[model samples]
Target: YMLARSTGARIIVEFGTSSGISTLYLAAALRDNGGGRLITTEFEPSKVMRAKANLAEGGLIDLVEVREGDALETLSADLPERIDLLLLDGAKALYPEILSLVESRLRPGALVIADNADFSPEYLERVRSLAGGYMSTPFGDDVELSMRLG
Candidate 1:
């Protein structure tokens, strides 16, 4: 949300909407920006249904697109891949996949915010490997960090 608010991002993409906490923040940011769109994907259909209802309740159905199916697969070349920010809040095992997807899609200086870094070995390694352009937030948990892919 800070990214969107600060940068006035017009296009944002997020993976995983388990409970829709981050989704709400993102949607609100987009709405408050006067114009923006957030496309969120979840593998499970049930989760998508719940997320749609939750987003609607949040008064953000129009600004958000809840896609049901494999998020990685759904992220086609034709879709809005050049994101201002990409949030990865799901499956640790898919960290590499997420990174690859971002690499292909995200624009230079785009931010990739990842979750559950401490618990995921693959994610940690990927972060380590990409240390050239990545750094953790110094203030708090350090779990929520950003990388400027240039």
Candidate 2:
């Protein structure tokens, strides 16, 4: 929430929307930011339905679009010209691929937060590398927080 609020994020892309818990947080941030959009993906149709209900119950349905499909496809197209924030909490092994899909759209200094990133050593190395164009460091336990450098 702080990241979204602090960044004044207007467009957020989330790799996972398991049960809409994290989605709620991001949607709240968008609402608090005075209006924005959140694009989150979930391959499970049941989970997607639950998430939509949750969002509606929270009165945040209007700010979020819960895409029911694989992140690789859902996040691949029709994205805003500039993405302010990205949350990676889906398949750990696919972190690098997901990052690549969103990398080009990330505005300069945009934040990228990854949960349970230890499972993807390649992803850690990529974000931590000086030449990767991201300034990154571990945040808390297994979360890696990075910002696009350019």
Candidate 3:
């Protein structure tokens, strides 16, 4: 929420919408940012149903479009020309792949947050590298905070 709102992120792409827990926060930030869209992907049909229900219940459904499929597929195309934020919380092993899918669209300085980042050593190494185009650092205990350097 802080990251999205503080950055004035108008378009957000989330790798996972597991039950819409994090979706609500991102959508709320969008709402407060004066209106925007959140494209979130989930692979499980049942979880997609629940996530949609939760978003509607939270009155954030209008601000979010929950894509019900693999993030690799759903987020591969038809995205906004510029994306302001990305949250990686889906399959731990797919972090780098997902980032690659979204990389070109991330506006310079866009924020990328990954949870339990230790699960993807490759992802960690990529983001942490100074020449990878991201100023990356660890946050809290298991989260990675990085900004697209362009």
C-alpha TM-score for every candidate: 0.85, 0.98, 0.98
Kindly give the stretch of ten consecutive residues in candidate 2 with the minimal lDDT sum.
Answer: 65-74
Whole-model lDDT per candidate: 0.75, 0.95, 0.95
Candidate 2 C-alpha lDDT tens digits along 14-36: 99899899999999999999999
Residue 24 deviation, candidate 3, in Å?
0.1
Q: Give one digit per residue, the lDDT tens place, for model 1 in 47-88.
A: 888888888898988998777778778765446757888888
Error of 1 at 116 (Å): 0.7
lDDT of 3 at 124: 95
Q: Could you give candidate 3's per-residue lDDT for residues 60-85 as a string of tens digits?
A: 99999889887889999889999999
Runs in model 2 lying further than 4 Å from the true structure = none
Local error of candidate 3 at 30, Å?
A: 0.3
> For model 1, what is the alpha-carbon lDDT of residue 45?
78
